[model samples]
Target: MNRLDFLKHLGLLSAGAAILPTNFSSIKQSPFTELRGGIGMFSMQGGTIGWYTTDGAIVVIDSQFPDPAHAFVEGISAFGTGPQKVLFNSHHHGDHTGGNLVFENDGYTIIAQKNVPALQRTAAQNSDNEANQAYAATTFENEFSFDAGDETINAKYYGPAHTKGDSVIWFENANIAHMGDLVFNRLYPFIDRNGGAMISGWINLLETVAAKANSETLFIFGHGKPEFGVTGSREDLLHKRDFLSHLLEYTQKGIDAGRSREEITSRTSFDEFPEHISPSNFLSLPRNLDVAWLELTNS
Candidate 1:
């Protein structure tokens, strides 16, 4: 029998694993990997941060957590004396925007989608930290673009995918797209249903965004499995799309068969799509299944 046939016969290749690296704390240093068009991605914690230097300005996308944000601030300062610093929030998620204060304190202009501040404020309030939270003062409805020396960085909202506030930050000259949590690479993704995530719509948006990108475009993912890392191309975006689509389809199929929430989500895995097994973000696959179930049945 063929490998696929043998797997079917043996009932092997069941569920996938969600694996988290055991050495997260050891990732303290701020490592910068250069991409196309004088842009780079930096990671300390919570979503990858994208930075660019071309003209006389520096732009940073997604400010990770507070401590890491401080490290990022110091790293960018060493790049040059470009006093014009701008920080962007890819969405209202704390991991991606918790460090807004790191730049705000230094007089950097903070930017994000219009819905971000409210979500940030609500999240802060939940933690009883509304008084100390840093939110983007500059907001855009759909598209925002600005020139920083020789490059024009652009931010555009694709309308409620990862979150209602999700925005795509693009380096125009370099063709590098910072997908935020919109593209989780090989890892299972966090479906922020509470934050207005639409799995079906999100799948469509993934294809929409992927369509805009060319073969040479370099995409930076918000998170990825330990082995996959956080950088890829159009194929990476489509891979994520496939995962979400399969999750939605699997959940709907169970629902159509009169399955309860637990009955549908209790499955060890979506046997049809086992490529995204990561014990690191283990909750994502099952959580996404639950969210998709609720979205299909309730909404």
Candidate 2:
């Protein structure tokens, strides 16, 4: 078969294999009919972007890959009676910030962490640049809070995860926390080593958030559906810890056995959590494993 045909077949196979049985009765119904302080996950592959509506204005968190970003903003416009006041970028990744310029031109105040502007500036100067840098404005260093009608959304920068300048936004009154790319849910996290990301710091930060969350807190990950009133419980936190622990142990074992990187990648499989693995999982796994190995072994 041709390359396009092969990819199409692969997509169908993956979709069929990944189907999970759902209990319609047990499915938690959303509290609001209209989009409130929650996320509307587009396609399965699309990044999870959040929309917060308060008073008449709306605040969007992270724009999906470029084209979707425009569509997302347009969708929000239909629901919003008021204007779009702000478009908050969770990080500097293209998937998150691609729609920045578009939204900025449409009169949205694009807010992000301080490092984001610097990153965008660097990108603009780079030979491989494509992103519009004019979108970024109003960056915060440590923390900032804004009152939206009855709710207050607090933006804070933790150490780093996913990328160097990852920002986590917490809705104080709504009890909702939007963890940019910090918590990848079940998927293998993309740690931008070039962006000064450290696995240890990332894991540690997640632990801190887990401790802070309660039963009523709504946990919204960067790439997953929002969980209502179910923040990271002690048990859930332990599961995340265990996932990282296993990755570390397996990687070390491969290294001690004098296995090549390719061999290590092929051997290690997160089959228990198939959702975590990508198509081949080999390429990304080695890099991800290498990062975890370096962090654990060196520390």
Candidate 3:
């Protein structure tokens, strides 16, 4: 099989997916998309993966799942060998960190927010999948930064949003930021209220991140509606913020008017965000309204 055929076999490229041009021909061989300045994105399942490959080190933002992670590991092999590998978990969600065990076995040092290990462990234990998890050994509370050759990686935690441990990993030199599950990009997000997700806080976090980014900065989102894709600009951030803000406002109004939870969550879709409406009620608008109502009433 040819290189394109090999990538398709690995499930990186779909049957009709277009292969965009990149400076590095090696990236074309696999599913890894080179954005700029050695930074790139890989999306297959779960949260999107951001990566930076240099002569000295290979840095990864999030791991999707064991199967995809293994495919990613094999795909990046074309970049050459003997580079230090590092994986950073965006949060403790199974979809994002499920591939931790795969990376752990391959000698990658995993890092995450301070609250991640316990959250990960608890989630694993609850699901009775503890053996499959690989918790982060090194963690930070507010911020963490490290130099990898010419590139510098910075991770920041802005309190609870998608999850309490949600982090934004920025590749400074590349001007690329990985928004983890924080900005779901036109998709109805998974609001992990049990894990400390707050719609108001999520809105604030997006506004702050967007304000900090310049026009040239590129963002890689954890998830997005198929039409929007996973990578976009700061406008996408504000678009998400608008969605969350509207969700809260609408829910708060419903509570003030003494609307029943059923009445409030009865709507299957929001007129403003048609893209976020899932046909199967998988991460549906009603679920977001339910979470928003609970949050507003402090229940």
Candidate closest to the true structure, highest TM-score: 3
Residue-by-residue lDDT tens digits, candidate 1, 1-299? 66544422221111112112312443444467777677888865567889987556889898876777777777776665467888899998877887888779977899999999998898788878675568888999999999876677899998888888999998877888898889876666777777888888788888998999999998888876655778888988888898888888888889889988988887656666576654433345767788888899885
TM-score of each: 0.88, 0.75, 0.88
Q: What is the lDDT of residue 72 in candidate 1?
A: 77
Better of 2 and 3 by lDDT: 3
TM-score, candidate 1, is 0.88
Write candidate 3's Cα lDDT for 1-299 as tens digits.
78754443333221111222222344544557888887888876567899888886888887877877898888877763435889999999887888888888888899999999898898888889898889898999999999987788999999899889999999888888999988776767788898888888889999999988999999998866656778999999998899999999888888889999999999777888776635234467888889998998888
**Higher TM-score: candidate 1 or 3?**
3
**Best candidate per lDDT, number?**
3
lDDT of each: 0.77, 0.62, 0.81
Predicted candidate 2 versus true structure: per-residue lDDT over 1-299, tens digit per residue: 76544533243222111321221234354312333344333322234567776567777777655455565666665555456478888887665665677777667888888898777566556635555655567988888788777778888887776677888888777677777767655545566766677766677777777788777666666543122111343445445556666777787887898876667756445875554544334225666887766665673
Q: Predictions ranked by lDDT, top down?
A: 3, 1, 2
